[model samples]
Target: MLAGFEKSTGKPPEELSLPWKGMPDLKTGEETVEIFRSWRPHSMLFNLPNGNSMALSHEDECPLHPRSIVVVDDVYCIFLGMLLENTCDLRSHYGLSRQVTEAMVVVEAYKVLRDRTPYPPDQVVRDLQGKFAFVLFDARANTLFIARDRDGCIPLQWRMARDGSLVCSDDPNVIAEACGNCCTFFPPGCIYMSGDHPLNKIRAITWEDDEGNISSVLFQVDLFTRLRSIPRTDSSANWAGVTTVDGE
Candidate 1:
């Protein structure tokens, strides 16, 4: 997977050879955690089933870029950047107190949208006014959700390792060192999710109203990197659209 990613992105192995040398094996949770910790000693790491893991650092590496991790109910979220608008309203809507963190609000938002909202997940993301990027995992539902703000305000990149584990982070140099040329920027104005749930589920990616009428909210990036609503019956529409950006 890593090799294929590098090839498709036009990054030759020789260019990445130097960084690839003396680098710890990133496929293991232990080594990956150490690599991230080397960058931010205060970083918190969460190891998931399979070789997947998540690391978050509360310390700001860049101005206005704060990283936070919150687990509410069974949902786990790692958020980078801030919610500059509607935060108070969101807290009120979720019945959360002022003490609740913004990361907590994000998890609540996902819960509401997944379980109750009639709108599609992407629409909810589009309506958010903030410079943010996040990765959410719902343990109970066995789902994964990822999104970035529309303007690409906060940096986010992801790569699939040779062992098929997905890696994501805001630091490009770390990604380059670990994933070589395999990494690609996670597109702005986009959301990547997994599972059969209505919110992020691409399988039929539809919403049913109280009246039982179904409407589609599925979207995909075309070859031109433009986002377009896709029909439910289009089986070819897959999560590959997440990395279908123009440059990569």
Candidate 2:
């Protein structure tokens, strides 16, 4: 993956760029027939957040037939993109004043695409990712998410695409250009958000697993917790707190 993130971070993958919107299909003069039988060198990308991409292979091994290793670099990706292009050019050419600089560490590391409201109402502004990543999209929560690298070396691949898209890739020519058929691999850090496409809603989450499920949590205690902390105007409150109408 970008020459093992440029040999474990020496830095140099076209100075880097995946800010979010998609771009990285570095194909030049024909590549890939690799089912075996010599011919290697590859990488293709796109993940401006919604463009959705990934396909990088670099492995050609054979140390006296070490169990006939067929293309030994099965994308165990640990991308650092060259220590993030030398810490984003040393925080923009040594200006680093700090507000968590490096442009707010690349915008608070994609701040849940702007404070999380969940899925495509322009998914936090149509996604757009950065930092040692993996991204797959069906767009506007059309399902199939596969983001990556919580620690896992970037190996990725996911399924669904007989005529239904919801893919993820690390080289089957990006599943033949977004699901013409190639789905399956993204086992990295793990971010697979799938209801299982084709207009997915398949319920069965059956009440359980709540550890960040704030139950729409609200906590206030000063200035009435900054003005009655929560209440988006269904407008009804009595007991001397005021505001109660309905024929009052």
**Whose TM-score is greatest here?**
1
Expressed as tens digits, the lDDT of each residue in 7-48 for candidate 1 is 222212131123223335644324444667787776676665
Any runs in candidate 2 off by more than 4 Å, and if so which?
1-108, 116-133, 136-160, 163-165, 173-248
Residue 211, model 1, lDDT: 64
Leading candidate by lDDT: 1
Q: What are the C-alpha RMSDs, in order, of all predicted structures?
A: 12.9, 20.9
Q: What would you estimate as the lDDT of candidate 2?
A: 0.27
Instruction: Quote the positional error of residue 90 for candidate 2 in Å.
Output: 9.7
| Cα lDDT of model 2 by residue, 1-248, tens digit | 21111111111111111111132432211122222112233433323233233334445312321111011112122222112335654445435443333223333333343244332222211222333343323333322333343333434443332222233334444335533322234333323333311111111111212653211111111212122212233222211112110000
* Model 1 residue pairs with clashes: none
Name model 1 segments beyond 4 Å from true: 1-31, 117-119, 196-220, 223-248
